[model samples]
Target: MAGRRRWSTEEILDAAAELLRTSDADSFSVRKLAAALGTDSSSLYRHFRSKTELLRAVADRILLAAMDDYSPEGDWKQRITSLALHVREAFGQQPQLASVWGRHASSGTGSRLVMEEVLQALSASGLPDEDIPARYHRIAVLLAALITSEARVSTVTPEEYEQGMELFRVAVLGADPERFPALSRFAREVRPLGVDRRAAFEEILAAQLAHIEDAVHPD
Candidate 1:
C-alpha cells in the first residue's frame, strides 16, 4: 500500500495559486484545491489553518514570483514606480489573486520584502523623517485602490465586460442633456474613445510621484 501523500508548504502554495489562476475567486475553496492536488481537504488544512490563510499565502507566492529577484533602479520616484508597476502586472496577470489582496493583509516573506523596499524608497525620498509614514501610507492606499480596481475588471469575460461597458455608455449618453450637459458631452466624446488601462495606470503613477516630489521640493 502507498504511504500517505506529504505536501510541502511551497508545493501547496504553488498548487493553490494555479487553482486560483484558473478558477473564480468567489468559487475557490480548500476542498477544491485539495482535489486539484489529488489529496483531501485534511491535507491542506494541515498546511493552512483556514481558507483565508491559504489565500493570503497564495497571494504572497504570486507577489514573490512577480518580484522575481528584481531590485528597482534609479531615484526614489523611479524605484517606487518600478515596484508598483511590478505589483500591478502581477495582479493583472492573475486577477483572482486580487481578491486575496483586497481581503487580506500579507505578513509573509513576499509582503515583508515589498514593505521593506517601499520604506527604503520612501526614506530616500527626501521627506522629513516625521512625514515618511504618512506618505508611505498614502502611496500604499493609492496603489491598492488603483491596482485592485483594474484587477476587478480583468476577472470578467471579455464579452461580459464589453456588454457591461456598453450598458454604462448608454446610460451616460442617454442622460438628459439639459440636466447633465457636461456629462452628456463628455460621454459622447470621451467615453466612446475607450480606456488604455496601462497608460492610465502610468499617468496616475506619474501624478502620485509628482506629488511626492512636490513634498520634497515644495514651491
Candidate 2:
C-alpha cells in the first residue's frame, strides 16, 4: 500500500523556504529540498510537478511576505517609497531568495498584486499617460538590481569581501587629481563609505525619487 503522505504542502513549502534562506538559492533543487525534509525526491514531485513550479511558489511566498502590514495610504511618492523599502527589507532578511529572484520570474498572484500597487502609484504620480509605463519599468528594474546586488554581497566570504573593499579603495584613492578632481578631492570622505551598502542604497533611492519628483513637478 502507498505510505501515508508524510508532508503537507505547507510543511514542504516551509522547509523549502528555510533551505533557500540558509543555502545558495541559485543552486536550490527538489532533491536537495527532499533530503532536507527527510524524504525522497519522488515525494517532493508528488506535491510539486517540478522544481520550476516549486521555485515559483517560493518566490510568490516571498512577494506576499513583503506585503505584510503594507499600507497603500499615502501620496504617490510616499506609497512607492514605502513599498520599495518594505520589499528591500523583506529580501534582506532572505538574501538567498533575493539573489535568485530574477531567475524565478514569479508572476503569480503575489507578483501581480505588487505590480498592481506600484503601477497604481506611478499612475497617480502626475506623469503623462504615455510616460508612465517607461517610468514604471525603470523603477522596477532599478529596484531589482539594487536588491539582487545587495544579496550577492551578503553571500560572499570574509576574504572575498575584504578583497573587494581593497580593490575599491585602490581605485578611489589612486585617482589622479588633475583628471579626476572630484574623486581625488573626496577620496578621504568617500573611501570610508565604500562598505556602507545601506547608505549607498538610500542615496540612490533618494536620487531616483528626486528625479521622479522632478518629472511630475518640474518647478
Q: Highest TM-score: which candidate?
A: 1
Question: How close is every model to the real structure, measured as TM-score?
Answer: 0.91, 0.82
Return the TM-score for candidate 1, rounded to 2 decimals: 0.91
**Can you give the lDDT of residue 91 in candidate 2?**
83
Q: How well is each residue in 100-130 modelled by candidate 1, as lDDT tens digits?
A: 8867857788888888888899899888889
Residue pair clashes in candidate 2: none
Ten consecutive residues with minimal summed lDDT in candidate 1?
A: 186-195
Q: Write the per-residue lDDT of candidate 2 for residues 58-176, one digit (tens) a residue.
A: 87777888886588988987888888888888888888888667666577777887899988998888888899888888888888899888888887789987998888889999989
User: For each candidate, C-alpha RMSD in Å?
Assistant: 2.0, 3.0
Worst 10 residues of 2 by lDDT: 190-199
CA lDDT of every candidate: 0.83, 0.82
lDDT of 2 at 149: 84
